[model samples]
Target: MIRVALVGNAGIGSQDHQNSMYRPAFERHPRFELVDTAEEAEVLSIAVPLAERGTAVADAIRAGKHVLADKPLAATLAEATEIERLAAAHGVVVVPAHHQRFGAALRSAIAAVRAGRVGLPWNVQCDFVVAGGDPAPTGELVNFGLYPVDVLRALLGLEVHRVHATGTPDLVTLLLDHEHGVTSTVVCGRVPALRDVPPGGLAVHRYRISGSHGVLAVDARKPALQVRTTDTFGPVWTGPGTVDVLLDVLAAGIAAGRAALGPHDAVQAQRVIEAAQRSMAVGQPVAIGQPVETGE
Candidate 1:
């Protein structure tokens, strides 16, 4: 069994609730034993906000423990890179919990693209937005935007070359140029909850990929289940048994002594987001793919 230490479930601020969500998963997993402090566990599951995540992961690494961090890893690309370097120096595994990649629609899309069913993907369009929950738009972007960016990279094997973005954090659009001649356009941000939905229809997440031979599309928010109540109704956003899936991946990665979603991937995703934020701020495109200097 892997002894697990869960870090930062203070549940006080923005993403602190994320840390608490994993408790049930850990409690139920047969292969995991939840410990109170980082010192007692061989692995650490860090679900703190982006700003606090780097410190948490670094602490875990210094304690000679592997880490599974929540998405985005760090608020800035430079910090993500620093975390990667630290993990490397310590010879510990550190990974992001990009649960969206394990979703059925994206998984099928990847399989089709790799099987040449979509022929060589040249252009992709993605929209992932949700109702804002009392945070700055940029923070929400950093929190959620990393999912699609990671998915695009995994599917196309492309690295971001440039990013152009506009609008506030509540609503923004991005044009991303990648290697391998692939391009992606993303429009994502939080907005006020829309009215007139039957409860489950408010989701804004969608994607379309065009290749030489075919096109792949996914409505990530497409409701799979709906519940009716006296006063409200809504769809369940999570996939069936996805918690189990994530648990399985975590257990396997721990057992194998590796990270399924490593720090390099986190940095790559953060680079696109940081570039986009910069692009919007300066009203110009930001170039990417250059090596960053993370001074020790």
Candidate 2:
């Protein structure tokens, strides 16, 4: 059994109306035991607010605990690099919660695409808007856009080459150019909390992909696809009914042992978001990991 501790997300404050996405998902789950503090656990599940994210993960690493942190692992690429550095130095695994990789609908869509349903995806579009949730403590691009950014990454399987963004932090639109001549347009927004939707819940979340043969698209599908990365996670679908599919990925990773912690989607998402911010500031398309020919 993997011993775990919670660093934040005690109240399930905002974003996604279910408590199961947080600490509640582990209450009776097998091979997983929750402890009272970080010192007592093998891993730290961090869902803290955006500002405290870096500190929380760093502390967890300093304590020799692995980390499963929520999105936007850090506000900027620099901070993300520092976290990576610290994790490497401390010899701990840190996996960011870019859970779209595990969702059933997106996976189905991806499977179809790979099966030649959409032959060589040419263009993509996605929009993610969070209508309410404590007024969003950070920029719309970082806090809300991370999901769609990750979705785009999963669909394209390529790193963003460049980014162009417009509109205020309250409502922003991004144009991302990826490797191999593929591109994705993204929109991220924030409005007042809706009385109808769950507090801090999503108002509009959507995706579309057009390829050489056909098209692929998706929206929110809460269920996680049952996955076993060779020997990573087992049949998680057989677990408790209340476990959020996203958190299920976390549970499986812990169960798989340290080497099972995989991918750096959060850091990649951070890179794209920061590129978008630079685009917004300079009113130009910013190249990621490449210099934009801004011809001063």
Candidate 3:
């Protein structure tokens, strides 16, 4: 059995709630055991806020444990890269828990894209809003950027070249230009929860992908997902977005000595978010140069 330790939950402001959404997953899995501390575990599953995740991850890696950290590894790309380097030097597999990427259904879609069913996806559009009517729109970028960025980047498998964004907090749209002439247009927002819907119901999520031969689309209302509302304590994860899948992936990574998903893609997602924020601020397109390390 793989012994695991979980750190952080929902957000930075919230105290460490040991009854995390991840708890049930680890304890229920036959191959896993939930350890009380990082010292007793072979793997650390970290879901701390973006600012502090870097330190938590680095500490775990230094202790020679594999880690599955949450998205937006650190404040800046440089710090995120350094953490990746630290993990490499320690010879431990460190991956980001881009949870949605590992869902069985989405996995099939990814497989189809890889198999050339779509003949190189060149155009993509996504619209996702999971909240009530009123929310402070200013915080939407931080609240909404990571998941779609990760998903779009996975679909394209290329670095973004430029980003242009427009709209107020209630709605924000972004045009992302990727390498090799591929592009994506995205609209995202998250407000407080709608009391009308139950726990499993999310607002709206739609995706349209166009390739040379065909197009793939997914449109759903109230799909089974776990989302946090402004009023809720935190996101209570279940279904495909649960922490169970992340731990399963981590266990397999440890056995293979390599992670199926690495931190690089998540770092790329952060770069896209950074560029989009700049785009929104300047009222014009922002260039996202390829990531390079300056060994300073």
Candidate 4:
């Protein structure tokens, strides 16, 4: 069994509570064993807030443990870069927990795209908006907007050339130009998920990819089934299943001594978000992949 240590407790892990998706997923998987401490584990899974993620991963890597951290690996691009640097020095792998990509709807959409159902995708639009989440230093762009940024990058396999963003902490829009001549528009908002729908309500997550042949659209909140518990009524298609897939990926990455999804993805997302913030602040488009001035 692959011995693992789970850190954090509120959102993803139950630090103060006894319930966590990671703990139960590991317990149910035959190939995984949950250890009480990072020192005793072969791998570390971090579900802490972004502020604590860098230090926790660094500590685990210094102790010779692989790390699988929740998204937005660090609050800043420099911090994410430093984390990657530390992992390399320690010869440990670090991967982001971008499990949403493995959702059934997204998976099916990706499959269709790869199967030539959407040929030569040129324009892509995505919206990832949900309500009632804590605010961060970087606002919605980093907190939730990174999802669409990562998705566009993963699907197009292109580098971001430019980014333009406008909006408030609760809502933001981004226009991106990629290296491969593809342009993408992403909209992310923070509105109450449980609020009553207005005239034309928007789904929590939506994607539209237009290609040479056809268009691919997905409504992530469209429940295949629903469950009505005593306390709540919610969709049956929430994230645990994808988290299971992520657990397996982490396990395989640990066994192979390399990360299946390395820090590059997280780094790119951070870079784009940083650029978007800059764009929002300056009221202009920001070119990505530019060399940072050392000011020596």
What TM-score fits each model?
A: 0.88, 0.80, 0.84, 0.85
lDDT value for candidate 4? 0.74
Ranked by TM-score, the better of candidates 1 and 4 is 1
Query: Model-by-model lDDT, in order?
Result: 0.76, 0.70, 0.72, 0.74
Better of 2 and 4 by TM-score: 4
Location of the lowest summed lDDT over 10 successive residues in candidate 1: 194-203
Query: Distance (Å) between predicted and true CA of 63, model 2?
Result: 2.7
lDDT of 1 by residue, 206-268 (tens): 789899998988876553667668866666655644455667777886667665668888889
lDDT of each residue in 219-271, candidate 2, tens digit only: 65344354657545422333234235555566665565443323356667878
Indicate the residue-level lDDT of 200 in model 1: 18
Q: Assess candidate 1 and give its TM-score to the true structure.
A: 0.88
Candidate closer to the true structure by lDDT (higher is better), 1 or 4: 1
Off by over 4 Å in 3: 10-19, 133-138, 195-201, 220-242, 292-296
Best by lDDT: 1
Question: So what's the TM-score on candidate 3?
Answer: 0.84
Query: Which pairs clash in model 1?
Result: none
Cα lDDT tens digits for candidate 4, 67-161? 87877677678777777777777888787877667667777787787777889889889988766534445566667777778877766778798
